[model samples]
Target: MGKLKLLIVDDVEDNRLVLRAICKKLENFEIKEAEDGLEAVEITQDWLPDIILMDVMMPKMDGYEASKIIKNLYPQTVIIVVTAVTDPNMQKNMSEIGVDTYIHKPIDKELILFKLQSIGASIRLKQGQFKTLSKKNALNPFNSDIRSFRIIFDITDTESMMDFGMWLFDQCADKDVVACGRLDLIVELFYKLMRQGMKNQENLSIIVEESYEEIYITIKFENIIVLEPRMVDILNAFESEFIVQKNILCAKLKKYIEEKNSNFEAERTTLTEETIQEIVELKIVKEIHTAPSKERELLRQSFTQKTCAADYVSDIGGDIVDEILDLASLDEEWRERLTTFEEIPSDDNLKKFANGVLDVYAHTINSLFEFTALAYALTSLGIFLKEKAHMVVQDPAKIKTLIMLLENLGYDLVAWRKHIFELQDTLDIHYLDSSFFSSCMQIEGIMSNKEIDVDDDNDMEFF
Candidate 1:
């Protein structure tokens, strides 16, 4: 509710004064300054700040020792070391000693504010952890942020795979597209292709007597199911669309192939061990995929690992989901063609539709893949208003624009699609702030090539 109390510790009086001025300018603060690590420790004993800004090379105790003592005494306090040290290993060493962050010398004011805000958020979340837990024991940001579900369908006919792909797309279309959704379709499609590629009984060159298994990987983001589980059912319905009786047909085909190839495999006896090892490896791989556990860990490591400089999720954010949705809805060729929506090719109507979608979504092309989506555009439209809507369920302007966009486009096909539009409307109605409105006006002017009417007597600050 209130601003966090922060203790700024630096041996230099000028540095302390500079930081104090910056902190005072921030909305809420109980700023206390300490000359060195010894003073920092003494201040903490009487008034423990929510976070500590400690200079690494402070007199009397130096930052590392102070941080160690502070952490031991008050484990809850987040300590960020400020330092002039440029050594690559220094940051790592400070981190090992319980420093949460390191602000290098000549710290930019904006960066300092960003770090403080981030730390402040963490502190507030920590304080309200109990309330959040009581409200939704099932949804923990630390744990429940990710969910994994598997749908293993037997694939016998290649045509069935095609139908399944369509079914899967239809299921996911109503919801936001996620990486998982793309993967789900891939697994289904690959199985179908692999099944089709399998030689007919007479043409089979080699056959294993043991029963083989089929498994595929599908990955999508949690945003798709932000509301309910009906979306997942839509995804699973693809299996039923694959008309062939998969288990029965697969068994018959395997038998036919083994019978035809029984004579050829005996010549390659030496490769048997290698083949067996490969199968074993494949089985291990299958077993390792225990729902979303491995998938989430892989993603977490990819984004959070020190080896990576960017937070992948924050960097790509919502755009990736949009592209995945468009990609899942179309064939590979369509995806490739839509990659560059520079000019609308005159070939087909679907290509034109994709181009429109691409134009709306491809804001930061080089950031990731050069594309955007209706969902992302809609989601981003809510960004400037999201802060005000913190008390409301959703942003109203975003909802209205999203609905209009969807309606103008052809997204009104699925069952209960209206419900989604309505939800977006509700969010927009309650939460849009003046900042968001100003942003919208600017955006609208840019889009419509119209200028805002400014009164000569009035001063209006544009966002």
Candidate 2:
């Protein structure tokens, strides 16, 4: 392929002479001269040059017609139309002829050389020898050869699926030697690796596959093991930082997920559109809600992704309602034997109430972090629900008993600490602490003025 077997075709002899003289600078490319389109077409039939430089205006047949005919007859031939015509229509017509490229005349030697070099590389790729360019050109800007390297991964536990998905996405931000790429590129790469991981049919149950222009990675697993609230909360916080914190960028989200949920089953599978949609709904949508319009649209999109998934039991089928209902309705005999009415004030009952409220409160906070009023209302409702649940085991008139039980379990401190930490991050800590202490002192003053006995049946809502 040395001295790219070049053909120079122009109606003017001087134009051909100038091009031939300049082309002599390149050690690779043997120059052949053709005057007008007809002779160029005739020469192209027997001798297949790696690239053709053709002039647009000529007698008998114009460059556009000749280029079109040559391309139609020999689709592999790379035809670059040379022209002085700047008219939009003429340029458009030349493109319609399937010219490899359009080079404006009154050419600078540097520009012509640059165009020729690009065309030479493009020709090699079209010839299905991209690997050769990769081997020869060490500094090749377009590293298209590495596009073939791809891998996939899978996780079994669907409940923790979102957690792991988000974690892997953050792995792309690793700046250390272990990290793969830029944050944006890493995420894109992770997706490709997950897709590839699904292709290998090993012991994998679920596969996350991903691929990039030069890299690919994947993970696989089966069902997820039960995770504690603290671990889940930590992962959720990282997910928030990745999406919410404007500047933080030290941790890998994927590394955190793997560490926290390593006990779960993982397997490999080809990542179809359905799998990608499930990941988006379960992982991406659950993390961020910075803007109301964006939140609403993203929620709708996630719902649509799930809804559009193929229907299959024991799999990530679309329809949240169906899954919930199936879980609740299954095991009829066990369900019928259970008592519908249970006391909520007993130790067992109070613990259940506390857990329920904690879960609902956590979910509500994660879903709508930006709205203070909404978050407060939801938390208050959770507290109210906890009271109602406790009333099942104790007299409704003796609500103070339930309050005492809740206080003894450090429920107040948990709520207070949660609010304090939440506020500390969002506002001036000193100002918030001062205001909170002042509010506490004022509440104490109000309680001190009241002559209510602790053992009495008087009921009061602190909120």
Candidate 3:
């Protein structure tokens, strides 16, 4: 509740005046003015501001360099880039230099106030001064010097999980620990993991450790189910481009199986000699239909040859076969059965088998998507805190590094979205549920407001 500090950095006197006027409209803000980035840095070094409204283009040193310098010195200070430059590349560059938020020129008064209020709320939350309810319960009292705590639960115990989450929040609240939304993230992650079919009796453990400088939490589980290969790809969507391609391939494979099944009865009776000759020429029977090889090279060769031969049947027939083979290899029994078959199985059986395989893959993919959505949700909260939290600010170096990771993740999410659309177009199937992408969209909604419910119990609110 102390007076929040504000630094307005702009080269133009008029621009500075405009920003100053905007800040005055908000409550309890002590304002400072700087004409350029260099002066901004100097002012920040002498007097650390809680929030800085900085213009990108300036004389001598640009806002980009100034912001970087100021952030390097004071990572806790929130920097909002106010500029007329709308070029995405420039905006991205600003983000790289540790700018937390952006406000374009011809700023609306309402937007400015909203941004200020949002940042203020985060700062108060971090400072551990923001209180949501008056009633105090006789739970464990918060301690500033406490270093660590551990809690364990049965995976199926939702009540225990909720109780633990609430207890953790209460401890932080009592201690005035500014976790920068980490508490919510931990609870949300637990919810997601539980929904992903964690074994009933498995142990889910959380360890929270704090130092004078940083607080760290780690969640662990023993006897947890391992992720399927497809799920692994989806979880790694941020780092890899193969997820969309894999999904597209899977859909095509499923369609191919369906088509082959429908035409099997007819092809069985009216098969032509030339059709047989083409099959022979493609050497499908010789290369892939023969003895199965355990060697990876042989499998790769078989996949290539079969896929190439399948191309003669349909435009993407080869790709479909390749994907089917790849998917079947995921299971040892299916791999052996597929290798031993003299010809493609009866249409009905093949269709059923392919559908079964795809169902499992889809289920795993859904779980992975849910995991990622929760991660993004957590990151969105972190992004909010990065813009607002002053207590327990992370090391400036670490914050910069995390900002880079966040930027990369944002780009990957966009790529993933575009790839999903492309897959839908190609397969005429909507593999991704609407909720998958909508969860990410919710991040923006979260950042704009202060009315999120953080307590599992209905009696208390965190913000």
Per-candidate clashes come to 15, 51, 0
lDDT of 1 by residue, 125-151 (tens): 446632321122122234542211222
Off by over 4 Å in 2: 1-3, 125-144, 148-463
Q: Which candidate is the best by lDDT?
A: 3
CA displacement after TM-score superposition, residue 96 of candidate 2 (Å): 1.9
Q: Which tens-of-lDDT digit does each residue in 1-463 have in candidate 3?
A: 6989999998899988888887898878899999999999989988989889888878999988888777655656888888776575775455444466666567767556655665665676557765431112211134322223212233345444543444444443223232222222233333444444444555565433222222334445554444556345434432321222221211000001011112222435664564455446435412321111122112122111112222222432344334433433335433333333213333333334333432333333232221222232333333343343332122343334323333433443333334332222222112222222333233223434324332213321111
Write down the lDDT of every candidate, Cα atoms only: 0.41, 0.41, 0.45
Superposing all C-alpha atoms, what RMSD in Å does each candidate have to the true structure? 29.1, 23.6, 27.1
How much RMSD separates candidate 1 from the native structure?
A: 29.1
Model 2 has how many clashing residue pairs?
51
Instruction: Note the residue pairs that clash in candidate 3.
Output: none
Give the per-residue lDDT digits (tens) of candidate 2, residues 165-223: 33332232111112211232233332232333333322332222111101113233232
Write down the lDDT that model 1 would get.
0.41
